[model samples]
Target: MITAYKKNDMTSFKIKVVGVGGAGGNIVQKIYLSGLGCETIILNTDSQAISRHRAHHLITIGKTVTRGGGAGADPDLGKKAAEESIHEILLKIQNADLLILVAGLGNGTGSGASPVIAKYAREKNILTVGVFTLPFEAEGKKDVAFKAIAEMEKYLNTMGIIDNNVISELVSMESSVKDAFDLVDRVVKNCVESIISIVQETSDVNVDFNDLKSLISRGGLGYFAKGIAEKPEDVDKAIESVVFNPLLTGVTISDVKGALINIKSNGELTMNHFREILDKIRAHLPEKAPIKYGLQKEGDHRVDSYAEIYLIGTTGKRTTDEVIDKITSKQTNWKNFEIPPGVRKHKK
Candidate 1:
């Protein structure tokens, strides 16, 4: 079970999670309902989509153009709507110190509005992070999704990309389509919650706002995975969950530029537990890559000892400007959906 932190406890910094479009809205709703310590907002071109979810704020963009209608899977139309209604969007996010923009790329609203909003937030000097998902191969929207991701990467301080194909692979064969999607939502929620806990919750070694800002803001992509252990014997299980997380497929562990790890136990954590976990992680990291962690005692007491580990890792040194050049150059072909090599894809 995820624990919620009170608003009053957020005295150190202000964080806001803005969900855009259908997939984005669902993810934000989960985070909000989980009781994480942050403000939540839902933005969509479709009024009905916004109505379906509850958030701290519900906004309808491009009112003059879209008039509460859906973007109809048109990226151009989606971008126009956000551009026209940016004033309203700005109002809701002006006070946020950290802005996390969640969206599902390849469709109209998410693919279009996400980049526009992220760019504007950065202009206000707000630290921005983007958590996005690509469409499955069968959707045939690879071009649309990659284009949006490239654009978003140019603006966001750091971003995590989860291929729908990879997510789908995690579900059992008998699971429904909805089950596969829910798993994606859960994975995203865990990431947002873990990052919040790292900075918001008090720990023996706290990872503060500055620590987070520094690590993610570095040029590259971000990766997140979490695991839980019920006893001393389960430490390896927990480490494997984090180090070899299936959600982070295609990652080159050696390319990791840096990482931030958070560990929580149910009041019975020992030094050996910490050492075993960190040592295993350190072995995979580049010698020069910086690593930071926060340790605390918190979790279920169903067993004598319980531990949860959360990791966020970064790879490569590709700056946002560099990525934009590669994405926008005329040599690039949208039809082919060409992106930097090494991003794995799956077929069903």
Candidate 2:
């Protein structure tokens, strides 16, 4: 195992991020290099693939099964590879207070190994959360993706999902495939950054690690979004961005069971800034739902002035079914009309 540390103790609440497979490895590398100060591990079946990443720890699984090759897009082989390397995987995550698993579900290692690792983490009494991306309809991996998601939910405390189909529809027609993927990566990175800021930064009205645990732990199907205001005058507009983010499509805020609102600014934060953001958030959530907020000061006022709103909301069983349906169901009326893989197009 390779290790890199910014702090000897990392943080009071240790967060470990483990990325499984190619897509996951790329995401973890971005997080590590971004200087989030979290312990990161990147695991792959292929030696060549694992060599490409620089992280806190790098691991190669299934030496016997794959012989340093790869899983060949087969999730079964991916699962077996992880099972073959369970001991090593368990060692990397044993000490973490919070374990965040990142993967793109559909094929091979990410779809296969992530759920297994999460199951192990949950058994160790770690608070596990998952951030995953769904394959587009054209990829023909919906069945595999949904199956992995079900397995993950069985073990994770909460999860944030990004549907590639939704993202594809939202991006400009002229944008390349790489550009679309970069946006997905940014969304996952923002989620991790939000968590880090809330627990690591000190505030007058603080939301500690325990507060976050109470709100998100075992609260299924969560939504996370980040919004920014260039100056104090635009704070309301930022709140609107947080609430109406396209990533949160099909989720109902009124049914939300728990909420966390973190505001980070380059300039001085005031009582009115907090009240305005909180009141707007409160209007959408149920009165009985518990809420926590954290304020953090960052950046330099001389160069730029901005307030970032990081909103995390979790829902109960009622919205969970609705949200899952929205992701797994087929939509035939899309304007672009990309066919699912292996389907023949009908003649006019």
Give per-residue CA lDDT, model 2, range 110-214, as digits (tens): 898888898989899998888888887898987888788777777888887777777644566556667767777887887777666666655544567776787
| Residue-pair clash count for candidate 2 | 0
Q: Please list the residue runs of candidate 1 whose C-alpha ends up more than 4 Å from where it truly belongs after superposition.
A: 1-11, 249-252, 297-305, 319-348
RMSD of 1: 7.5
Q: Estimate, for each residue in 212-325, the C-alpha lDDT of model 1 and write its tens digit.
A: 788778756666767777787888877776666444333434556887888888878778888888889888778887787877645435324578888876665585555444
Model 2: residues with Cα > 4 Å off, grouped in runs: 1-11, 248-252, 297-305, 317-323, 329-348
Model 1 error, position 72 (Å): 1.4
The Cα local distance difference test for each model comes to: 0.74, 0.74
